[model samples]
Target: MAHTAEIQCPRSISEEDRARAQFYQLLGTLLSAPPSSELLRGLASLQGDETLLGVASRNLAALAERTNPQDAEREYNTLFIGVSRGELLPYASYYLTGFLNEKPLAELRTDLMARGIKPRSNVHEPEDHLSTLCEIMAGIITGEFPCDRNLISQKAFFDAHLAKWAALFFTDLEKAQSAVFYTPVGSLGRVFMAIETDAFAIQ
Candidate 1:
């Protein structure tokens, strides 16, 4: 008879990991769709300290307070969905390979499969979409999947998919002509990505 071995359960995620995951999730949520009135209201209540990232967060909240859902929706459409293509394309493949659904996207898909990550049935965007990638990072930290969800795994995924292109994209977004409510969002992203990059480098 063959001997069976016990499978050790994964360790519980730390509080710091949970907070980091929530930040990624927040980014994913904000980028995934136009901000609803409730979301805008929540944004308007955000407060921050004296640091650069905190200042950016405060600015975002201030902008959110002044922005209405109708205007925000229009801005979203203009920035992300123009008549054909938006001013900016938020895809890893496009940023890295200069084309949609290119090699980067294919590589991301392969990795996602290897990690047993399946996209939601209703999600039509490729796995390399910025929002999708953010959500994946959050899931990885939260151990939403059975695979490796350690700090090393989180760092690997972020270094590969987000660290290179996400900051550039956010910088573009901050300066885009159509950006109003999203400008502060872009600033926040830029600062957050820099922090994440630096933190990961030191680890």
Candidate 2:
């Protein structure tokens, strides 16, 4: 369930930005998961109005069908965990505190507990893991929360974690040596992060 102190969004914004916030929430979710046939099918129902996301989504949809896991995995490893290490760590703690399982993880644990969110027992990754955070954003947007504080929870969590290192990660993803199908994914993430960050700023 989403925790609410006084019941409000993380920021005050116009109606239009709320819709955009939903977009970021959904984008974060999709990025966390490898492409599935059902997710691909659902994405086609959305229509965009010639925005950067609109164009990118169309292109992504066009390419998703041909995506091979073996190819994507090879690229993912080369970019995220190469022979030594990738150009970036793709972690909030590493980016913010120069190490994993640092204060950020401690802080995130506090927040998660407060909000009644628990890390899945089967998932051994740290709560501050990028993929886990992305999944949380999806849950927030999708009303998996026990309460319907989706937008507010989405904004708060994004402001707390993802709004920090996601851009840099996406940028690295864009330039990584093994990126091919992932190049566009990187571009989309980068662009979406920029848009979301700015919206949060102005809100």
Candidate 3:
């Protein structure tokens, strides 16, 4: 579960980097919980872009304009928290190894511990959850965690845990039958991850 709080910025970074980190935080927040009325309203106010991501942004904002909070909640539940399992399982472990709580998750936990990061006590989901991973990416950029990780460390973490699986998950989310409000989210995530992967490759 995501806390209703701002994404902390430990210090100043390039404006582009700051915006990228904010985008990750936004995705993390939206995926971790259903949108509140205020959040939906805020989303509705956003303008769409002309780029591929912009198209997704516009569509999502348009969807938000007509979506009631209750209906959005129901859609979220149906897509992510159906009675037992959701239409898609948004976990690194599952996406990587075809099983939940598998080696990928264990490896992620080890890496997180090494970086002096720990999952929130209230969030019972594994650290490999999509939302958790997004939060970690945001933290890496923002230095929200206690440790001082440089760009190299950030790239290493992304390559190890996120680069392989996140894009696939987003692609699945984009095509899921239950997706409406989440489709644009899927687009945003997919495009963002692609950008991250390419960015890290040359760094």
lDDT of each: 0.85, 0.65, 0.84
Error of 3 at 108 (Å): 0.7
Q: Please give the RMSD to the true structure for each candidate, in Å.
A: 5.9, 5.3, 2.7
What is candidate 1's TM-score against the reference?
Answer: 0.92
RMSD of 3: 2.7
Output the better candidate (1/2) by TM-score.
1
lDDT of 2 by residue, 47-151 (tens): 555888777666665555566666656655666666897555667898888898998888888877776666655666567766667656655554454434445
Per-prediction TM-score: 0.92, 0.72, 0.92
What TM-score should be assigned to candidate 3? 0.92
Give the winner by lDDT: 2 or 3: 3
Assess the local accuracy of residue 35 in candidate 2 as a C-alpha lDDT between 0 and 100.
49
Per-residue alpha-carbon lDDT of model 3 for 1-203, expressed as tens digits? Answer: 33223344557778877887888888888888899999999988888669877787788889888999899899899988999998988999999889999999899888878777766668778888889888878877776775565789789888999899899999999989999888888988899899889988999
